[model samples]
Target: MASKRKTSALLAVGLVAGIVSPIAPLAVAQQLTTQSTAVTHTCELVKPWGLLGAKNQGTIVSPETVVVRYPATVAPGEVFTAYVQPGAAAMRTTDGRQAGLLSYDIAFPSNSTNLAANYNGGGSGYSIPGNGPALVDRVAANGQLATEGPFARISGGATAFHGANSRNGDAVDRWKAGMQVASNTTFRFPEVALKMRAPVSLANGSTITTALKAAGQSGDSDDPTRNTIQGAEEGGWGTERTNYYFCGSSANAGSLSTTTVNSSLPRYLAKTTTRMVTSDTLLPLAARTTNLTAEVSSTEELMSNIRPGGMNFTIRHKATGQLLATVPNVTVGANGQATASYTFPTLSNGSYRDEYEVTATYAGRVDDIESSTSEPVTVSVGYNEVNANVVLTSTNGALSGGTMPVTLRAAFALPAGKPAPAGLAIQLFRNDLPHGAPITIPTGTTTANYTFPTDTLTQAQETRTYRYRAEVVPVISGVDRFVGGSATPVAAIVVGSSPGSPLPEGGQGSVALEGFFRAPQLVWDWLTGSIGQAGAFSSGFAEN
Candidate 1:
């Protein structure tokens, strides 16, 4: 519990990059704010699960009008607050769950400003009206609190979790409420105030807005819920980059209700430039990695102390415009640069060997510094080379009439200390034609084991000669990052005939060809085997 308190405090003051932090502790920020703006917005709430225990999702159960007071004119490089008056009459859940911990999401009107989202804003919500003291839930008092996040953001701001607020999916958070909600006349969720900062310079009339959030929303895998609010999502994000909490205990998470306050301010614009560079232009999809860096500069504005804030690196296909991957919140250093190492995923539209572009969008701590996108850098992602060899372990030196064993080995020319390829698919071929569908190479002890079956021979003058090889093939719905390899085929010769006709009369010279010594033969129906011998060939004395 003590640890959670510390974390709550850290969130308000988390952003440590250039410019003054909008999410800073209120006492430190209020001193610099001298102006304020008020905006009224009407919000709608739709919940399907009512008292009837039925699911009527997307049905608007309540409509709310919220008044927000914000800093219309802010002191450049100073932090301020957007105060929201909380108002809700009756909020209940029919899912037999008393699990509703509420919070709100703040979206600024422009990229010229920034927002800071703290879970509880270092204070608990007022379940009752402001006349009451700060309300702490009795359930949460026992340590079973609702889940809130100090999740990282791409622009260095922080936010709480908002997603499939349901019982079906266990996301990174359980979205449990700290306690059951009860109301006499009206009730309010916690943390009605949101923090925001303005650029060092800006224009006037810039506005900010927020919305009431319940559980579940649009935009996640096409999800729609009663809590869905159009154009009012918590935007700044990272893949656990701004993560500030672990999951909390819960029975079944009740719908969370949130109200984020908003304010607006503007100043003159400053010109900013962003530049990007990568370590490599040609990267193999098998090992697609590069050190990507972006630098932001401003001639008139100061660009230093970008510490906690950073840029977002987006790698996408140039031709198809399919977004591949995004490396978010790369911290900008005091040197005005942010660096990160990124790997490319397989291209979906084209072959694995496709061209990609990397772009960096800067999100600085100071709003006046101006957010900019770096010029894209192009890189090629392709497959690595794979070489193959077929080793013939055949007793039939000539493809005249005997069984032969062989193994088709496909080897990848990887660097030293790199692990060899296994589980790669290959297809056997006879005379440049596929023998069958692709087959996977089994993972051998420290190597790949690729083996083939042998064909037996009969004493009937069966004459056949064929060249067999192996070629790399698709890995059955998997993205194969190895170039197709065609193995050098082995020439198999098998010639058999009736004993009298096959012996070639009058060949006086006898050769003890490949005959293992001291093994008694047992020949039945032309299939001969010694006492403890296999795959033995003899000419002088017909033996196996």
Candidate 2:
């Protein structure tokens, strides 16, 4: 009795972690912020033998009471507990990033008789007499315990144990960490009852289970209230028994009840827009810009689950179905919108006719299911005007019979490897004014050709000069295509000298010298003025 009093003072506690390495305590409190769903159930064992009498037949065996508690929000370094009355197996928790192992801490008061010490092989059981509290660091195999310091080994031992025989293997399932009896009056327990923390990478909504049970049980029950305790359960304990020679027919415990307080489900929609953007005044080889924007919102306005880094978009060329770009990190604004901008390579001179599209997808957090892709937005790319050059050259430098031959060359200036411009018209200008009706020219494989009629310019009785050049007329609007260009202006002079007029110098002649040279000199001066005007006109046109 004296040794038995000392054994009553000690208690046992336990816990577990699945990983080979132990979990470290967290420095800061990292809560999940979401409400945790509770999982609870009950179990019981009874006897059917009426010879044992009512009190012994229907004994409320196993754990008389059981309660498992979980933190509202589990985080790194946080702790939870489970309460078992007298007998049971083990408890479990939902598996998540924050949940890894089950750490059990049991305290046995000194001189307390709540615990029973049983020896191996159904030997006589005894209680320790008055003695100071003693803690045994042990590893359990089957229902037997061996002394080993706490936290000395990785936690992956069996959770249910038989009192004397090694009832491991299939007997104990679905649980980790268990204990065995060392002596009739003493117990070997884990030095530290701690469940290693889970890896931080585990996502929200992950679940884990913790359970408790006795090592073995008899096949027969004496309780009239229930018979299945010792019998097999479909989809449950199966044919496994929970009975040991020292502790015969250990009973199963009661279950836990929980009512859901709220419901959590995420739903939203996403959309995007793509457009070709250009300057108001288009230029040749201008860069093309495609602006993409995405918007996301929950179908129910009451809930808002969009996070900052929860959206993305993709751009593609429609004609070739080629992917142009993908933007993965789009920050969602308070208004539930995100945007991306991309500039295409500069385009060469030609009729650009291509299409592009953009699509968006939401990258939600845990519990927030990813949203479907947004509707594709399409835009077209093409030129509104033609890019070509026109040049005018005189066939003859001098004018006779009040006529001069001039040629107009219209050539499309396009980037290398590009097809020539088609369907072009040219308008010639002389002396800074329209010289004649617009002339339509047929396009060659490369250049368009046109000829100015002879006598197109008439010289006065004296000598004069004429300035000529061709230009592209404005015909296209509300669209962008080829860029417009012009050629350098050229000039021709006509010197008028009658056959009757005699040239004289240093000596007298039939005609006066001054009168003879005066007309031609004046004509020459007028020609110079026309040349100047042509230059000024070309520069001014280019500026506009």
Candidate 3:
């Protein structure tokens, strides 16, 4: 009981450390002798120094098996032995009598020798029997009975190592029994050699995946169990066979890697929509907002498995290459898409030349290493310039049959949030053509002064309601930005008056007639005065 408990503890420790060896069953013919047991032992296979480069561990796909080849140079006929001694249990004979003795077993397959000798060795191959209860049996008059036998010769090249020893006949068993000896015997045992077998199959349709571990450990693989020394098997009490053990480094096998490939199709399709809120209350220069929406999807599947919360959007100024805004951690809707909105900076009431672009990138999750970026979507920002009429006035008075003085006043319509225009230039036209070169003027710089005067008009040529017009263009920092506008045409009458016959009146009649005639001259003077003051003209004629 105590011995079994100790072995159980060791087994538990091995399992906890991930050092699991194959568990082979005892030979079917090897049974207890219904008597007392004796000293027990254990043994393990060791890789010889010559085969240090051999493969010890690996993994394979289903249907394929793991085949651990032995050192090619090793041959048959060389006896392999395991010396046994009293472990947790004291030595006892088959007759239930305590015996101060030890047990031993030897194996020597005839495959190498017999195959060369007769071109066949049957099923007699090498194998380490599975661990079990003490092999001690009823004590014969000659010695303790043996419980393990050697491989038997049949009619094949070599037999596959079986879970149990062969049971051809008692002759082979007797020979195997004779091979066992007491610890005091003079028989010599060869150096331990690694024991391996044919490819091991897992199941009918099963795959095997071995997770390689970080190396540099002493007992990572099926490391040999050593109680006996390496060279000549010097000082050791017993041996423990490592059943169904793999014997090499897994690092030398292979490696795991991954490659990333980009596709022409975007992981998410993005579209941007932009518009200005043109309300009476809102400033003409109010900032415009743009909404960006991206549809997340996978070309491999009908419906995209991509969800929300792992995506971000970047809005950039396409013209200036500036980053406008960044929207992160956006959630996708049930329709497999996400949306974000950003408003551009407020600008003056005028068309803008700048445009914005948006792009979305997906952050990958578990089991899926593929990530995608949406193609850039563009949104143009613009505004309508407020058109203003140019006003035409006179320096002296409305044009008449004599020389007339004229001045042109132009008002620029700047957007709400835009900077003031740098300057202004005006052109007066008698009839749409450059009115005798452009009149010198300053515009945009300030709100106070934005006007120019034309040269005093010379004597009229054919006076037929002389028409006048003006054009005003805004200058921004030496650049002509807004389109110029034309003022409404105005006409001046150049009529002639005939002298009235001498008044045939006397006394008050003559005086009243003189006052009435003087009224026209006064009215003409008043019209000129009103023109100079920028007052509206009631009618084209002089009034009382």
Candidate 4:
């Protein structure tokens, strides 16, 4: 009976590539060459029950079958013994009785290698002793036996379960009731593959779990009891299990339960959207002092159920809708996308408008959306033209020769309706002292007249007195031109010398020029022009 050639090779230690196939292998080598050699198998049903309960009674029952002898040359496309039921059957009885075969095997050896058998069964409740089936039926007499029959069938038909604690104490509900297999029949044993390795490669906040050990097979084995073998889990099985399931009790039966698995296997993970391409109305305008930028993008789908957490922005002012600022969360990586920036503050002259919106929240709602508004930014605040003044006329309270010249007149007030500043420049100062610089006033003039000269007079310059000042210029620009005050200080001017009619002890020619011309008037006209032609008409320049 050799039709079963099941060869599954998934050597995925890092998985490169693979494929292989060959079904029914000669109907299991002609059903082990025609059956019966003396079938006398007996062992009713021992039940002390314990796949999950009553081995010591913590309540975990389900795997309990005891027949002991049934493989004595049973041919017919022979591929002997392999049953792994349990997808729900009163969860396999516990209080309702039925729980006792934690292990089984009787001559079990038909993993097909081209039909051949020989065995005798020597026992004591059997624990191994040439096991069973083996009586020399070595093929090759007429050489024609390839019936091809069971190698793997049972498509689905073994529903028996119950595992929430019948006393195996939650090993993921006892490996989800032993890998819930509903079929099995294969020969040419020696084919087990399952691999997964990790050194470090799952970045972006990661998590991983892998544990599957059981390779090849032989005798004294260190721990190998899948009794029937099963594997395939990522999120759904028994009491919410995930992986691993094997059984062959007593030998300290343990190592092969491990649940809680998820390497991502459910499919369907789409749905995504993000925006803010560009449109705060193209934001810009305010004497052109700009720096307002905005950008946002998202689409989703990177695995691990579309994970992306971070992005929340809100800024408004579309015309008094007024929110103005709020940017929180913002992290978006794993290729989802995110970017934001805003700066626009110096626009205070005239005409302005704005509006913007962008939203993208995943796994919690608000998928992806964007908006923009802007256009109406006009500004201009500027105008300057200043003029100031202070001027006076009339001065001289008492000055007996030393210095004099204090005249003044200045005025300006342009910059209200403009007009009144044509080539203007009038700045004068003396007793009001602002000395040196500004005294132009000449183009059709706005009135600018000033004078001052000095030379050290005594008597405190006849008791002191003088004043004058003026300034204008700053039209329509940055602004800063001033001057106004001081133009009324006039007093000080008196000089005398008369009285001299008897200088006669040493007198000569008539002397009647009072005080002798006070020694001034160029010394009395230089002593009357040297006294020569002054004989007849000169009676000492009298009377006036």
lDDT of each: 0.39, 0.34, 0.31, 0.27
Which residue runs of candidate 1 sit more than 4 Å off their true CA positions?
1-273, 277-293, 297-301, 304-316, 319-354, 360-375, 378-396, 399-427, 432-451, 456-465, 472-484, 493-544
Each prediction's TM-score versus the true structure = 0.28, 0.28, 0.25, 0.18
Quote the positional error of residue 439 for candidate 2 in Å: 3.7
- lDDT per residue (tens digit) for residues 1-544 in model 3: 0111011100000112342233211212111111111212222223232233322211111111111111111111111111111112111123221111112111213121111101111111111133212222211111223222221111111111211231111121211211122222222221112121111221212221111111111221122211111111111111111111111212311111111111211121211222222122122224466456676664222122346335678778786789978888777666556766657665434544345677787654432223467777665555334334445554435444555555545454444444344345556666556665554343333232345655455432232234566665544332124434544455343221223212111111111334323545333533544223334332222211
lDDT by residue for model 2 (1-544), tens: 0000011111111123433222332234222121111222223322122223211111122332333232223332122222211222221112110110111222221111111121111111111223212222232323234432111121123222222222222233222123322111221222222222222233444332222222133222222122112111101132121221112222222122111111121111121222222222232234456555667665212113345435677778776788978878777667677666666544435545455676778665432223546777664555444465554544443334555444444444444433343554567777788777766544333455566554345544443446666676544323434344455565554433443322222221222435433546433433554232333312111000
Best by lDDT: 1
**Top-TM-score structure, candidate number:** 2
lDDT, model 4, position 389:
44
Rank the candidate models, highest lDDT first. 1, 2, 3, 4
- Clashes in each model (backbone N, CA, C under 3 Å)? 31, 67, 14, 60
lDDT of 3 at 336: 56
Task: Please give, for residues 390-409, the per-residue lDDT of candidate 1 as tens digits.
Answer: 23222332222334333333
lDDT of 2 at 212: 29
How many backbone overlaps does candidate 2 show?
67
